[model samples]
Target: MEPAAKLDPITETALRSLHDIVVPAPVSWWPQTWGWAVVAALLVFAALLVTLRRIKRYRANAYRREALTLLEGVADKLRHPATRPDAIRELAEVLKRTALAAWPRDEVASLSGDGWVRFLDAHDEDRTGDTLERLLDDFEYHGAEIVAGLPSNVCSDLVIAARRWIEQHVSA
Candidate 1:
């Protein structure tokens, strides 16, 4: 191998005079323009609005959630033959109380029989008033002997209709 070449005195002096390249300062995290800051603020404002609307809606439906829980208890009672009649009565009461909670008392308190069922249908999105007719109108007030005469699916259908109404009824 050839021996390393020695740099001339003038070339060595020139090389030593060269310094490292200068690095620019890091870019700032703040926006470059006022318009970009305005856009960012608008986005944050819109997000806060959407979040507040969702929270308000959830709070407004607290009664529906409570009614659903009561319906579940009635459904459990409906499973037993002995409790079926009383459960039907309780289910009707639950519907009435739920309606009272969502609507004015003058509109819901005095309703009974067909009027009550009609009120329920008017509020229910599914219009399941027919399914709840007999249970709410007659059987709710009848003795255990009358309730025992109901078709086997009647209790379940009533429960389902009640659940649907509780979940989907519109408030006044």
Candidate 2:
């Protein structure tokens, strides 16, 4: 026996049409969305890199400025003839150590002989000329030489040379 419910031909056709229209095929937009997200992430990464480079440059400049100030102060002290040789020697050592800190300690600290001479020679401040190297070398070689008295003028000249070198080589 057939069930009492029977669909008319017109109703059957409409139901079939509605079923096809209402049921859509699945869509895949996940890949497109991920691509856009990746692009945004790259943009953020580039911005951070630029910012870090700028910060590094700023720190380098600051370090150079501080080093210059210290060099200038030492030069000013040297101008006073009353300053003792021991004091001047101490100042020179301070300058050398500061340079090492600015540059590489292993390279500068291990430097000696003519290599050291050339290093100082490259600066070429008249006051700093041969005398500065001699004083430094003497202290390194004889330690006792540090106690010897240094002329006020010599100390002043060394300071002048150091200032000139710092101004020329150090980053602004």
Candidate 3:
């Protein structure tokens, strides 16, 4: 190995005076301007409004949820010939109650026969009132005989119409 040569006094003095480079601090995550902060606040407020609207809508439809649960039981009963008559009556009652829940008592309570059918048809998006009319009009009075005479698909069609009415009826 060769011996190292020493620097001149002037060069050594200049080298000793030098220091390491200084780096600036990292950038902040917070908004740099008031406009950015305002935009962020508005976005948060819009999200909160959307969340609250969804919660209010869910709470308002509580009756529909309950009616749907009741309809499931009615559907189970309708599967058997013995229980079909009573289930039809209960199904009609559920539809009436659901209408009452979404509309004023005076408007829905007095409705029956054609008036009831019209009311159901008016609110139903699919206009399935005809399918429900036979069940509502006859099942209440004729009892088991009427249900016995009905085609097998009648009960299932009634159930589908009722479900559609409950789900799509407009609120007054």
Candidate 4:
């Protein structure tokens, strides 16, 4: 038993030598983790920008379709004599509203007082510039008095005129 106790010191030295060769682990892994995070964030941002442009295009297309529909409906209604003054005014208002929705409402509405005259005329086939006001006036103030009542043929002509004007006015 005395001989066995004496052997312990050599065994301890061998065990310590084996442990020294192994390297310790790092305390932090943030640098490597953050590199991956940054790349992911950039990809997300790129995707978002593309999505936003597509959404804008889709909205614009929808607005164009809606405006065209409104104009078409108004033209169809105008294809008859005895068209109501109220209906004409309403249709004009719809066109105005649709224009405002597509463009700037305040600016377009203000154009009504002055520049609007030229704006309309610019799109007119004749370039008379006062056609819009003339048409509107006919429906609003003159329809009941001067025109008395819109005849189907007369209304059809007006419908054709309006359709032509709108077709030329709106951009694709």
Candidate 5:
């Protein structure tokens, strides 16, 4: 064979089999390395937001929670067969303390007699203030008498009214 006719072995193989350039398939976008971390971060952020909201709600109602607990204790005391005469006074003290808690201490701490009753009704949407005032008037006269000694219905009504006052107050 003429030297010029002798084919290079590599060139001969390339000529025997030929196809389009074999480009690798494009990289898939899914199954990313950082996806789980991103999801975990979002979940943590959402949990933080919910936790903050729960904490805020609990703090804002702390006074209401405390007042209700105190009222329940007073009611339990008044429910006994040999209840003390001072339960009325106790209820009055609870009301005053609740008022002081819900409002500026300076505003409610100095209130007395009718002024105190009026202050209570100031926040009362039901206008039970007059009745509460009458009850308070009776309180001064009625010291720690047993629940049976006084008009039981009236005393019970007073307790209910006091509950409403604490529950319905606009502020903490």
Candidate 6:
């Protein structure tokens, strides 16, 4: 059997006509929540911190970048077989100038021959500086004498050593 209606048929009909089915209220987008604000702030701060660090590092390593460019020029100079001795001389000068610029001039300027090589080896991580020092000894002293030509392999080795020295040495 059906249960009896709590309201009269007339009252039920009247209420149904007045309103449809109920629903949840719609959400508004006017105001941002605290969590979202904090997240946005943190993201901005992290981005700024990264940018500042990159700038500082770029500034600090400027000398290394310049030295690498000069080393590239030395490679170009070495391309002509006839110019190997002059290129070798130029290579030593570039490395010396780069080191001198990075450190105190007095400490680096007067150093030559094995003394210069030892200084370079002291800064080098690979310990191949003695080989490079030998090249400087051979080429720098005999830059004008083209009769005793330096081997192509030796010149190339000097280039590699100079590149490593410029890249790996810490400014002191």
Q: Which candidate achieves the best TM-score against the true structure?
A: 1
Tens-digit per-residue lDDT, 7-57, candidate 1: 999999999999999999999999999999999999999999999999999
Best first by TM-score, ranked? 1, 3, 6, 5, 4, 2
Which ranges in model 6 have alpha carbons more than 4 Å from their true place? 1-47, 143-148
lDDT (0-100) at residue 88 of candidate 4? Answer: 73
Q: List clash counts for every candidate, in order.
A: 0, 0, 0, 5, 4, 0
User: Residue by residue across 1-172, what tens digits does model 4's lDDT show?
Assistant: 4655555878889877784466779677554677788988999999999999999877766754676677677766565444456557656676566557656666577766446556566646555434456566555556454443656666555555655565556532
Error of 6 at 69 (Å): 1.6
Candidates in order have lDDT scores of 0.89, 0.62, 0.88, 0.62, 0.76, 0.80
Query: Model 5 segments beyond 4 Å from truth?
Result: 1-54, 143-148
Candidate 4's C-alpha lDDT?
0.62
Which 10-residue window of candidate 5 scores lowest in summed lDDT? 139-148
Candidate 5: lDDT of 6? 79
Candidate 3 ranges beyond 4 A from true positions: 1-11
Model 5 over residues 1-172: C-alpha lDDT tens digits?
A: 6576878999999988887789999998565778877888899999999999999988977877887888787777666636635566678888888777778888889898778877888888777786679766666455454334666676677778888887777664
Candidate 2 Cα misplacement greater than 4 A, ranges? 1-58, 76-83, 123-128, 138-150, 170-172
Candidate 1 Cα deviation (angstroms), residue 3: 9.8
- Stretches off by above 4 angstroms in model 4 are 1-59, 80-82, 123-133, 143-148, 170-172
TM-score of candidate 1 on Cα atoms, chains taken together: 0.91
Q: Mind giving the per-residue lDDT tens digits that candidate 6 earns over 98-161? A: 8887889899999988898888888887777766877767667764555136566776777888
Please give the RMSD to the true structure for each candidate, in Å: 2.1, 12.1, 2.1, 10.7, 9.9, 6.4
